[model samples]
Target: MKLTLIFLIMISFLSGCNKSENDEKPEKKELELKSKEVLEATDRFGWELLQAVNKEADPGQNVVISSLSVAQALGMTTNGAANETLSQMLDVMDFGEVSEMNEAFHNIREVLQTADPKVQVDIANSVWYRQGMPAKESFGEALEEDYDAAFREVDFSKKQEAKDLINGWVNDKTKGKIPSIVDEISAGQYMFLINAVYFLGKWQYEFDKSATKDEDFTLSDGSTMQVPMMNQETDLDFYSGEDCQAVKLPYGDGSFYMVIALPANGIELDEFINSLDTNKWSTITDNMHERGLALFMPRFEVECKFKLNQTLIDMGMELPFSEFGADFSNMTEAQVFIDEVMHKTYIKADEEGTEAAAVTSVSVVVTSVGGGGPMPFRIDRPFFFAIAEEESDAILFSGKIENPKQ
Candidate 1:
């Protein structure tokens, strides 16, 4: 008989934009071979994850998520998986091999953290296990060496103390943008693998605060509400697609950007989102060109929380969550499986730029779980947006704003 080990993993990501002046742009560097491959793979995975989550969301509801955070946390956990569990995770994430994935993630983290001196990007990882639980030495070593993860052995029986330790790290890493992720620790839960990312950068071109004014924002329901819309007329990387108008707003030193896409007048936000795929996304992003134009977007904030177990199962990653069939023996001597995945996100976009944060927590009782365009480009209606790195085009955060006020 296999002894079941319950594991919980929490992944959190945070990004902030403040007003600043940095006239110099960072020099573009060529991506290494492994970095390039992983970027493409993760980008594909990110899109698929976004579409899946959107499908599960309520009609007209807002959604924001950090694909990088989810990938990092799961990537660390993948080190412990074997057999079909490993294969399914690799297939779902679009990764080629384990060694390649590990090396690539390490390289990408290095590149992203030092991408621009003007921008601040921090990535952190941790491993927490029950005080006496036996875990594979190789598993912990890989996480520490490849992902720079910090390890702590805690008394799981002391639930409140363990919870505080984990949540405190999250709060500190996110600069208090997200106060806590683990609400309570269950009895069967033994270990947690976590990843936290924090990013802060200013816009290359800040919107004038004086120009922001009350404007009508059209909701998905066709109702309209007054919102503080920021207006700007400047040169920006713009794309005119058959389905939507898109623009890329660069952040500090041009190493990062926020891409916003507004579906054509008659198209619904959901319809446009459903039509998006990796192929279309690449083509649209590749075609963007700098152009001078009038731009209007509301200064708004959105917070979203979701339980993503069924979503991942629907996406063809079911074995790891299974109680009987799950194989995480590579991680520990005991049989373990995932239990739940919880994701929460917050974003605020204004004239200064955009500030966003997300936390994706996977609880393994062992179970678990688990963009646009432009125009003179008025975003008066519901639209999609993403924060990404310019070099690899890796999406750090992505979401839709149905109504900014909500």
Candidate 2:
């Protein structure tokens, strides 16, 4: 009952995902430090995810890697790196003392610790069904007012107090990186999960806008589109040989970078992604050198939302949301457990740093990257991407591009 009271209190101040764009911006590597705890937590999670991608992905598109790190999330000028930390954590239903998973939960709380107490309560967030279902019933009267319905009522004309209060708080923290906190919610949702993000960044060397060109981009399906590609010839960490096709673009001070792994011709994209290993990731990072190279980036931003219930089931970690659940007895007794889990994330970028965050929740119901390789993978078309921090290579966001339409 005490645990229920605490969680229910959190659910009141919840904020659902305000999905944003994937707009790309110009940024260069620079020197920025991160909390050591955040670094270890992020990398360990990223490593675990690499292990999963190495096993489960399809032949052509099996392993996709991308990230947004704490540094990048908190940055003002450069994207953190390919973001992968959160995606892996979402797939796992139980932590089971695994160092990475444990560290991950710790890092999340660490970030939360920095937030204002009112901010935490105002979000009224948690993972569970809210309609007095068997799960939400634990809270008695504390758990009323569905966050989803509240989101629906937030019209530009007449906004709900809950939504406005939370969004304003997030905007202030992120320096406007996250302008809107609640995009949409439903009456049937069991839990109201909210994640706030903040970021600021600048390019080491600003792009000469005059050099931007409307170039042809060959997508995976052999289709082509005209995109404004930011092209620059600079000294970069480049590697090319029989085993790989790749390059690393540094932002600002050379402490962080964006690495692209291109698949070799004739090899299936999914196969290359699925066959990924830590060494392959290592090679991309290890072989990187400061050399003269050409950089081409399309000016584009994409925002998407997806129901990932099926995707999580496909992964190996499947115990908590089920009748066989995570043991949260430490929080309270009375056989309390998670019911359902949901996750929502958003990212946006351009000539500079990336601003992104992921939010996930588990109820009486439930809840829950990248790189490289031999024969060189060319991501000229649809491919996996990540945003990572340098020291720990903490990935904050991760996703696949099988059919962006969905």
Candidate 3:
């Protein structure tokens, strides 16, 4: 018998913005920068998540995560989280209060949406639920107003049709890079909170395609494999720190870029990762200087599809996932708890530039809960990566490419 996996999907896209715009006055920009607390909190949250997920990553496997996407989805869900469940979720995300957290997300999203006219950056949020299981007005309004999420009701019992509708939205938003994010609507799943981000941009300094060649890449197991490697030499922001060497490769107008962190010689990748925090990352980025360097990066495409339940738990977000411990009463009158947090990502880095897409689904099963840097001087061995916006330093996506061939 053919198995049909059922699940709820929360569809999100990166090309848009939350309807509620944040203060964008010049004075406000200065204030936002001076008050580094928001940046610190967001970076701290991303770092903690990277470490937690990295610990669970398979040895020598490629791991990619859109922390911004995941955080946005959970932050929207947090609007419905209350009391201890809300407190635990906030603590894990490093936010002092819910109001502060919402504003931070708002500001970050606003900056990203308006960052560039050449680069396609869209962010979208939505709520999908089964018919007759309508979300509470208050909860719905909070998501619709604050998060700028669209809501839709469907008969999830028609799993195939529902899957198509949900996946089609994802495909359209990501330009078909991520064709589908959900396979089936599993029983007991009542609602989903989805956040999707899609980005396509050309490098400020494109590499010479004729110069691309298959080169040897040393794997973690001390073995080598030949991969199509792209080479370039240019003036870019570079940093050499005690733990790692870093480089920033800008996309389009330079408001967005890729930061690669290569661990210093003799330092293990895991050790370098564990040593990262918001403060350290801020210092590293601030200290980078314009310098010329010869860079060789692999021309590769990779994807990761996994459930983040265990990872979130390990990061101290247990209450939201616990059926008994969860308290998402604001989302609906019915008792609900988070059953799973599903994430999917597609990324490609070639001679021209980089394109990436991510979709995160936070499933509320009648109970549920929710929810880095470079030194690249060469990424031949395992190295950490983060695609971010410069002005706000908002991390859009991050991961370690253990083996591009994977």
Candidate 4:
């Protein structure tokens, strides 16, 4: 099995939105890439969100998440929002306007989906609503054309079947890596919008598994555990920061790479994570240059699951989840609000390559907050990692490994 990680975010909104887009598919048009300003904004949003959700991590526990999945799902949710609800969501997401963010998301997806032939990056979006829910025409049109999302009518009252069908779609999109995203559909959840991204890539320079050996991985509390260590020494883009060290490991054609950042000894991982910003991130990756250094990393896996309603609220997106204060009139004529947002991610890294997937589900009834250098980069303790596209600088998946043994 290749080093693989899967991330899933399930957002459950309480209110339902628009109807099916017309059956006929429109002629394809070449989409433009996101502007530098918007792309930078998107990157900043990811980092800020990383800080927000990092608050939920437990001491000495691993946490990994997909910022792309969260942004895509919430961006889709913004389409049907209006008034204060829309404003707050946009502010929290750091998006200027719904139209611009929609385009940015489309462009980013387009670039990533077609980045390289050797690497497989697929992003799929869909909407499933209870049969007879009267979602608005404008809302449906936006979702169809702007987001390129498929629409399905389901009997949400038949909770079990509805849950299974939605979960099956996510499983299929993630290549069966994520079998199910929804275990239960609550009483008032009239609709669900889901986005899934699956990525598979081979290391530009593969590690020799034959040289792998068990080594000691130190924990934050000074405890240690034995883990399979993979060793490689090549001229890789490396950077050293005031508080951390980082390196970029290219994948496939080098359009995409995994950047890992390890905190300097004596710097707490949480302290470093809290202080990270776009400037700090840029300072590290921008200063990176090809340097020959010994790289020793543990081969490990991480699975993180979270309910993001509170995290988002903490990030200044409180109105959407407020059952009484939300305004989703653009989606439906009735009173509606978001309820909850759920996220789950899984990742595994070894010698050959890396494979990862993420799913973001938004239920209308309710919800949803929601990188590095290299140096001798011995990631013996807690550290962070991000997989991103070089051109757009869009972060696809990111996480912190506190203790891989768990």
Report lDDT per candidate: 0.80, 0.40, 0.79, 0.78
Decoy 2 TM-score against native: 0.57
Write candidate 3's Cα lDDT for 181-258 as tens digits: 877687777888888999898999999999999988888888999999888877889888878988889998898899
lDDT of 1: 0.80
lDDT, candidate 4, at 254: 91
Q: In candidate 2, what are the lDDT values of residues 43-64, reduced to their tens digit?
A: 5445554445434544323233
Worst 10 residues of 4 by lDDT: 1-10
Residue 26 displacement (Å), model 1: 12
Q: Considering TM-score, which of the candidate structures 3 and 4 is the better prediction for this target?
A: 4
Q: What is the C-alpha RMSD, rounded to one decimal, of candidate 3?
A: 8.3
Residues 1-406 of candidate 1: C-alpha lDDT, one tens digit per residue:
0001001101111122342323232232456798788888887888888888998888888988888888888888889899999999888988788878887888787778768777777777778887888579998888888888878888889899999998998888777887888887887786777777777878899999999999999888878899999988888988887799899999988988888999887887888887777788887789999988789988888878877788878888899888888889888876778777777777777777666667667666543331233336788998998898888777898878888888
Model 3's alpha-carbon lDDT is 0.79
Off by over 4 Å in 4: 1-35, 366-376
Winner on lDDT (1 vs 4): 1
Write the residue-wise lDDT of candidate 4 on 1-406 in tens digits.
Answer: 0011111111112223342332121212233544455667767777887777888777777777788888888888888889999999988777787888877776676667666656788888888876888678898888777677888889988888888889989999888877777877877776788888888998898889998888989888888989888988778898886798898999988988999998887888888888877888788889998878779988877767777888889889998888778888888766667776777677778898888888877766733311334346577887888998887777888878887768
Give the count of colliding residue pairs in each prediction.
Answer: 21, 103, 36, 32
Q: Total backbone clashes of model 2?
A: 103
RMSD in Å for all candidates: 7.7, 12.7, 8.3, 9.2
TM-score of 4: 0.88
